[model samples]
Target chain A: MNESDLPSFLLDGEEIPFTPGQTVIQAALTAGHYIPHLCYHPEFVPHGSCKVCTVKANGRPAAACTLPAQAGLAVESDTDELNDLRRTLVQMLFAEGNHFCPSCEKSGNCMLQALGYDLGVMTAGFRHFFPDRPVDASHPDILLDFNRCIFCKLCVRASEEVDGKGVFSLTGRGIMRHLIVSAESGRLADTDIALTDKALEVCPVGVILRKHVGFAVPIGRRRYDERPISAQALDDAPRMMEPKHG
Target chain B: MAEGRIRVATASLAGCFGCHMSLLDIDERLFELLEKIEFDRTPLTDIKHCGPCDIGIIEGGCCNAENVEVLREFRRNCKILVALGACAVTGGLPAQRNHLDLGACLSEVYLTEPGLVNGQIPNDPELPLPLDQVHPLHEVVKVDYFVPGCPPSADAIWKILADLVAGRTPRLGHGQIQYD
Candidate 1:
């Protein structure tokens, strides 16, 4: 079978070729199509919790990251209606957390902040929850600012799968849900997690931060600030090179 | 004084007047803007009250009763109200206090400080009572447009005003639409 014979899906009217097991987002990324997403890192199994990548597939809302692409599936994305939904979700995320972009150390590189800019979120749109979450600086190398967490759970999965350490986990339910360190002392220092753990790098927001190296990159020159997340997504996309049939 | 110049008024409530300073950062372009608009109750004019105006630019969150009163008055007087900065748009830095108990905050600042000998929370009839949470301008009154930045860049403010003066809807592009 030739690469041209691979199953293809319609993404905003463009044909995106996909391997049998590839998700819509993976296929789209492989085809150089950028889909807005969080909590859908290619390195990990798609959690589909963020829902920023919600797109219409066959007239039904689906998380593009988790939805497996099938031939002839018409996906509607980059449309006014879908983008408006994404904008509202991003705004709710902003309001749910105490995201003060101006003062935050992760201002430029933050995915939530970048998504806010990409989605044209002018205001939080909803009344700010202003939850009083404490900053955990118990670890000498890491700083956990709970106020900026968006419940993406990337850190949780990264710690568990990549680092082979279940140092992070979520507790509670719905509005009260929280990320907790796996330690009796309830502190990052008490856990066996090291500074080299992949979990520290997986957080999309400022919740997990490397101490002393913050603000090292100037505001205008940081990852998302240099190029909007849309462009950055394409730049960082994993290529699915044409598979040759033996 | 011009026959058809747009009447423009600005206010700084629970704000650092950084947005006004950014407006002044328009530098020599101020002359060009002045040709098409007249100040009514801005820091530039030092006028105590807002009058009927074509546009009202507010820069700050409503943190107290006086802020709410002033904002309502501005909304009543101006046909178009612009929320000009992060504070006006999203309650900004002042909204940080929303998580803390207001009474505890008052006590911490006044009565419990180490240097204070006999300090008490100032309770005067003239001082406006503070609200529990600082609210964005739109929460209190309808806002026609928003220029969202810490103190939106001078160019951003200029573009909005120029667009308005030219009968165009103000639009801030990607680089101009900054939160910081």
Candidate 2:
């Protein structure tokens, strides 16, 4: 079939063409439209956990990442109502964790930080939960600051599918839900996972960080600082997912 | 809706006074700002107590008894209250201690450090008692606006002030609104 003949859907009044079986987020991104997301990485299967990518599909709320793109479907993202909801989600994530961006190693490069900026989140809308979580610096090559996890499960999916290590998992339920390593000792060093594992790079927040290279990029010169996340949203997924040895 | 100069007051509760430094970073612009607004009880004026003011710009989170008292007073006295910077907006760095037990934290710092000889938690009557959890200014009192950088860029602070002076709702642009 001709590319022009491909079925298209309306996203915020712009017609976005999609191949068969493509999700709304994928189709929108392919057409250079940005949908704010954290859990729906292109390389990994859509987890639909983070509702940051929520869009109104025919007046009903749905996760764009998981929703299949149907022809003539009216999807409402980029609206004030949706953006405001996204901002609230980002704020809740900030309040739920110890996300002190200034002190975090992932300050500029973090997706959550960039989304917060894109959505114009000025404050943590809810009271800070200030949960007491563990930090695992046992791994020789990586550090896991569990306090910053938003429980997106990108790492969990990446480890299980791509790395074949099953190195990460989520345990508990509701507010009690948290990320855990697969080792009996509950430490990254105890797992067979390596620095090169996709799991190490999939964290959207500062939860997983490579040691000795924290602030290599200066504040103003870092990713999302140079350009707002909206301008670079489509490229960010693959760019971030691609492994860099250095 | 005053006829003349808008009165502005500023206070630093548990902050490092960096936000005030950023405000002063307005530098020569301060002269221009002074034409439209008059200082009420800021450190620049060295006034100890706040009077009824048009704008109260507060820096820092509520980390002690005095901070809460001062924040409530600012809310009571000022028509508009601006939470200025990460400390005032999100309890900033000092709030990193929110996870730790307050007693243990004080003990670890004052009683159990390696190099300390007779370090004791200061108990002077002049010192304000520390609250168990550091709270953002909004948690203590209603805040009208928030300029939420670590210390919002001098330009950001100036823009907010200028907008308020011109009777406009301050809307920070993409690059202007940052948390860190």
Tell me the tens digit of each residue's lDDT in model 2 across A106-130: 8878889889888878888688888
The CA-based lDDT of model 1 is what?
A: 0.89
Once fitted onto the true fold, the runs of candidate 2 whose alpha carbons sit more than 4 angstroms away are A237-246, B1-3
- iRMSD, per candidate, in listed order: 1.3, 1.0
Instruction: Identify the leading candidate in terms of TM-score.
Output: 1
Alpha-carbon deviation at A185 in model 1, angstroms: 1.9
The RMSD of every model to the true structure, in order and in angstroms, is: 2.2, 3.2
Candidate 1 per-residue lDDT over residues B68-160, each given as its tens digit: 999999999999999999999889999999999999999999999889999999899899999999998888888899888888889989999
Q: Please state the error at residue A67 of candidate 2 in Å.
A: 0.5
Pairs of residues clashing in candidate 2: none
TM-score per model over all chains: 0.96, 0.95
